[model samples]
Target: MSVSLMDFHADWCGPCKTQDPILDELKNDWGDRFDLEKVNVDEEQDVANEYQVRSLPTLIVENDDGVVERFVGVTQREDIEDALERAGA
Candidate 1:
């Protein structure tokens, strides 16, 4: 099965910068299993607000099946793997 990974971040946010590498690692490792999209809060406020992301580095792992998990803050890479596994990736 396939999943949708949405990352909400802003350019000026420090946490967003810190989380970028982690997300890059995740993408390189899991790209084949999921469709990853990065949405900037500044440019994609509609999407960000819809997801109720109050933080800079928010991650939403969803599918056409709907969101399986919503993570707020700088998530650990292993935790992300766990979420993917729980989502049946």
Candidate 2:
């Protein structure tokens, strides 16, 4: 199975704000191949701290067993697609 994409973000963060549309587009394109879960770091401080999320727009790719990779910032489509492939999407 493909790894789920966990998106850590905060509404107050500029880059995170910019990532919303991109994520929406990706969800539509990738379909069931990738699962995207958006988490608001500010609203969910415990999750942020637990996940060790130190930056905005953090993308954590976790497979059925565990995490495969972690990406920080607004990720590009190509990069994300590559990551998905690596995660065995």
Candidate 3:
């Protein structure tokens, strides 16, 4: 089962800017180990609401089983990797 990282962010969010690069680096480094999906809250309001994303840079880590972790605000790369590991990515 592939792990997915759903990044809920908006263009005007400063913290999301900071979080983007970290997730990009991980996506480059990991390469096919997991799926990284960026959800622009402005454009994807329904998806954001479904996930109950109330903050910028919310990282939702999930796999076939279900959601493994949900993090709000800027998150550390290590923490995200830990969540991926937990999801058996």
Q: How many residue pairs clash (N, CA or C atoms closer than 3 angstroms) in each of the candidate models, in the order given? A: 0, 0, 0
TM-score against native, each model: 0.91, 0.89, 0.98
Candidate 2 Cα misplacement greater than 4 A, ranges: none
lDDT sort, best first? 3, 1, 2
- State which candidate has the highest TM-score: 3
lDDT per residue as tens, model 2, 1-67:
7569889988688998787888889889888988888898878899889889998889988888787
Which run of 10 residues does model 1 get worst, by summed lDDT? 80-89
- List where candidate 1 sits over 4 angstroms from the true fold: none
What digit string (tens of lDDT, one per residue) describes model 3 on residues 22-52? 9999999999999999999999999999999
Q: Is candidate 1 or candidate 3 better by TM-score?
A: 3
Give the alpha carbon lDDT tens digit for every residue of 29-86 in model 1: 8778877789999998998889898987999988667889989888899988888777
Winning candidate number (lDDT): 3
lDDT of each: 0.85, 0.85, 0.95
Error of 2 at 32 (Å): 1.3
Task: Please give the range of 10 consecutive residues that has the lowest summed lDDT in model 3.
Answer: 48-57
lDDT of candidate 1?
0.85
